[model samples]
Target: MDRRNIQVGDYMAVTSKLPNLVSSTTAIYNNTNCSEIMKTGNPKVEIFLITLLTCVFIFGTIFNSLAVWVFCFKMKKWTETRVFMMSLLFSDCCLLFTLPFRIYTTQHPWPLGDSWCNALLSVYFMNTYMGIAVITLISMDRYVAIKFPIKARTLRSPKKAALACGIIWLVYISIRLYLALGAKWRNGESCFRKDTVMPLKRALYFTVFGSCLPMVILIFCSTQIILTLKKKEKTSMNEEKDIKKSISIVKTNLAIFLFCFLPFSTGNIVRFVIESIGSDCSLIKLINDIYYAAQGLSDLNCCLDSICYYFVAKEFWEKASLFPRFKKQLIKDQTQESSI
Candidate 1:
């Protein structure tokens, strides 16, 4: 490499012209091809993502909001289970409120400065951990209810559940607050989606403490509950219908939990492994993409839970039957109109 007496302007020209000097024509062809492909295909992907995200946001926000409202106002009786359910609703709503941020980010560049981005990222991680905590609580609640109904009835109160959920929030916040504060805005992406060492470490921690550990607890508690139910059926010589109902509830709940969580956990695991390996195959990429889609759907389970609980909580349905005010009013209105 010989030093040249070339002027700064000449050097600048050469540097700027470097692209034109080497393979520039080929690069242009490739770029043009990419642009055409994107123009034709990218819109479909964008449209699909937009529609999917919109539905998720609408249903999750409405249902979780409704669940909170019902728990607060309509349901006078609050049990430990109800309290845990409310905690889940709160966690879901935290993410639900931020959906618009994500939607806007997908379409437009990030307008909110680093401060809002960091704050929302914190909320995103904090509530995600809280959701795991609530799910664990729900599983434990069911276990206690089935395994030691009498003891659960005595020791487990909504106040205790509320206190536990509060502690979970504090822990979740503490674990993530440092990272959130440390977030750098230079990435120009949603802080949550951006991959960084701190984020990866936090995600792995969540995979263990928030997902895997809770999953263990859930499985153990759910198994114990099922066993207890089985014993009750055998010992009491319970009615076939009662035994079937109990089994059905347990199966349905277990399925719901696993269905919503397993894919997300798998995705996290894949992420961890990929980060560790630092290379990926097409299959791995596909799995990751599927996991991302599945996780989005899993998050939507907050809305699905409204439907699940509406059906699963037979007691709720029975109570609704008792309060026929709306039903009777509609019937009366119909009769009056018929008379006319």
Candidate 2:
């Protein structure tokens, strides 16, 4: 048998070695909280994770880059949704920047050195939480816009949205800054450092704030938005468009939470519990595999968000349509002038 050390979350790992436990039925413990290093080396896991991260990084970068350009240049009118999405786009880019290092680390040593590794990991973790925050805020914004369109005007302003995003970035950077400075370093599969005891607890605390709490807020806002939409009938074209946009935003954010995010987040919590219970190494292996897979799925949110948040927005595609229309008109005019 092979000995594998799995660190779930930050430092939730087996510090002790588990070898040939299959033959023994007797329970054994050096300490109730004794950390053991369980042997788990899965090349297939690294391959799959790298593949997923690569795809997400490529597509996410392109889509989000275009979104940023459009929001900054072409899309003039600023709505709460647009402002929130711009913030999300920046967060996605930060995550995207970390993927190349992650993929590189899958096959090679950490080339950028320990200091850069720490910085990169901080960027990765920080942006992930930042996205969670922005998504939760957008969900609430949409709910208010739909439920109380008139009253929401005061609540939904570009200035206020920018302020919220500023706060999110500021707070997130502060927390991650501390982690990067303090986290222990080593080369690993994901390019993130292995967690020790203190770091693992910190990771858990961050996860609760970043994923768990935001998830609750998203679920509530989504429910309210859906109910409000269902209650009111779309009497006009504008209302129909409003309804569609709201639904798109809701479903997109919900999909990110329920599908991409929820799995890994659930895995993180479960793995922590099982590790504390001192389960079989084989069982631990299974949980570790699930956690890795869930992590890949969570990364998929960057790609999927482009569809739900950017492409689905009429303003985005509509403005993009203008270039083609303008080109066609120019061609038509030149042909007529040449013929004359």
Which model scores highest in lDDT? 2
TM-score quality measure for candidate 2: 0.78
For candidate 2, lDDT tens digit of each residue in 168-283? 89998887777767765553332553322212566577778789999999999898887777677778876666666556556665876789889878888877777766676666
Q: Model 1 compared with the native: what TM-score?
A: 0.73
Tell me the deviation in Å of residue 338 in model 2. 44
Best by TM-score: 2
lDDT, candidates in the order shown:
0.64, 0.70
